[model samples]
Target: MHPSFQERIDEVGELLQRTKAARSGFYSRIDRRAPAKPVRYQVVGGSFGMYQIKDLTTGKTRAFRNDYKAAHDLAMQFEAKANRQITVAL
Candidate 1:
């Protein structure tokens, strides 16, 4: 990884942390009024952890193969993915 790319990734991580911190109750289950519900994926024999990536825009829902990983990578500023199909929202 080039130094410049690494720096960009670090910056993206910082932004994600800040956003998560701003919404502490998000990933937690303490609030019954949580806006989103998690979706599950049963892939043959794979243990797929569930997560969601809301458009926070059109309010449309799509499902991903491996959600959390997809979301994390998408959060990165240096992410090189041009097509969104690799990441489906649920």
Candidate 2:
């Protein structure tokens, strides 16, 4: 036999509570808030063999010794500051 309307409603309520959709607000805030800008770092190499780390948004560059590791480390530092849970592409 098919479930009654009340029984179906109760089942859906339990499912929503299990998924935490019963109190979700993330979707409602999307239209009211501006999208976030993604952080990006570019590693540029100089002619003199030195490495430069550039912040794409600000056009600011920091110089590092001719070692790629140093420039990569600088990029990682920027990533840490931007979002600790996410990593930046090299």
Candidate 3:
């Protein structure tokens, strides 16, 4: 026998709720496998008031700067490079 109008509507609502739950579960699984954000570079003070840009992830020296201006320049250069890569990816 065909379902009444209200019965069909209720069945559809239940199916929609189940589909939404399944989709959310799938998305959560994908999110769990995604890579973490890249660590940022930092400029730290050294002896004699010098500065050095270091990669926070690898603890490697990226550049040495005699003053804040030079340090900022290096930071900007890295930022530009990252931005370019992002644009290219899209």
Candidate 4:
């Protein structure tokens, strides 16, 4: 698993516990409010393939498309896009 996946797992765990979002939505296993908070992630060209961005700040990571260039571009854009923004293609 990628490092970012671990980070997001931690972050989401905390988020789920705090909000009890896991019990919400059509599927109790899914969090209804999961999409509420803004997360930073990227999908850019990587050494082997596309990569995801691990938020060095929160120690949280998210998996994005496996593309190095795409990941790098989104990482750069996350610096400017609003929190409401989720996906952006570069």
Candidate 5:
């Protein structure tokens, strides 16, 4: 016995759906194995109106003289980059 044209098409569609589901599960397992740590930033005050943006994850620091806003902005940027998501349009 042979499948009709519509039945063949349906079989292909089911195969494609199964393949997609398996791929999704594979990636999900990979994601669970190595979870991402949230980036932490700290703004420290120094003498002579100096502000520092400290990245706790990497133990790196950036200094700003009399500019708290710039220091805070840099810290915020680092946090944003660490937490950003990649989106793909199909």
Candidate 6:
């Protein structure tokens, strides 16, 4: 049995709608996994003048004993690397 012209048009329209829905779902999944903001690092002060490198994105901290320069440098390095990753991901 042959499908009438109107039926064929309706089928094509339904297919188009399904394709759009599938594409949106795929992109939504990717967006959910992608970082909402660029990763950042900061040098935070701790007790007794101690310093630490803090990952602002993940809220993780690494301690350094009164070594602000080292902590700052490490934070900068992390931030740079994170920027590179974000650029590559985009």
Please provide TM-scores, in order, for all candidate models, with all chains considered together. Answer: 0.32, 0.45, 0.47, 0.34, 0.44, 0.46
TM-score, prediction 1: 0.32
Give the local distance difference test score of model 2. Answer: 0.73
Show model 6 residue runs off by greater than 4 Å. 1-39, 63-65, 86-90
Prediction-by-prediction clash tally:
3, 0, 0, 14, 0, 0
Highest TM-score, which number? Answer: 3
Where model 3 places Cα greater than 4 Å from the true spot, the runs are: 1-39, 86-90
User: Mind giving the per-residue lDDT tens digits that candidate 4 earns over 1-90?
Assistant: 999999999999898786654344434455344545454554433456647676655666554756666667777677555454577889
Better of 3 and 6 by TM-score: 3
Q: What C-alpha lDDT, on a 0 to 100 scale, does residue 5 get in candidate 2?
A: 83
lDDT of 5 by residue, 1-90 (tens): 356988999999999999877867877878854324545888888767788787787777755546888888887887887687989999
lDDT tens string, model 6, 1-90?
A: 456988999999999999877867877988864345544887888876789888777788854647888888887787777767443553
Q: Candidate 3: lDDT over CA atoms?
A: 0.76
lDDT of 3 by residue, 6-63 (tens): 8999999999999877867876988863324443777888768689888777888889
Please tell me which model should have the higher TM-score, number 5 or number 6.
6
Q: Which residue pairs come into collision in candidate 6?
A: none
Could you tell me the lDDT of residue 62 within candidate 4?
A: 51
Q: Tell me the lDDT of model 2 at 83.
A: 69
What local lDDT score does residue 22 receive in model 2, on the 0 to 100 scale?
Answer: 26
Error of 5 at 55 (Å): 0.6
TM for candidate 2 is 0.45
Alpha-carbon RMSD of each model: 16.2, 16.7, 17.7, 14.6, 16.4, 15.9
lDDT of 2 at 82: 67
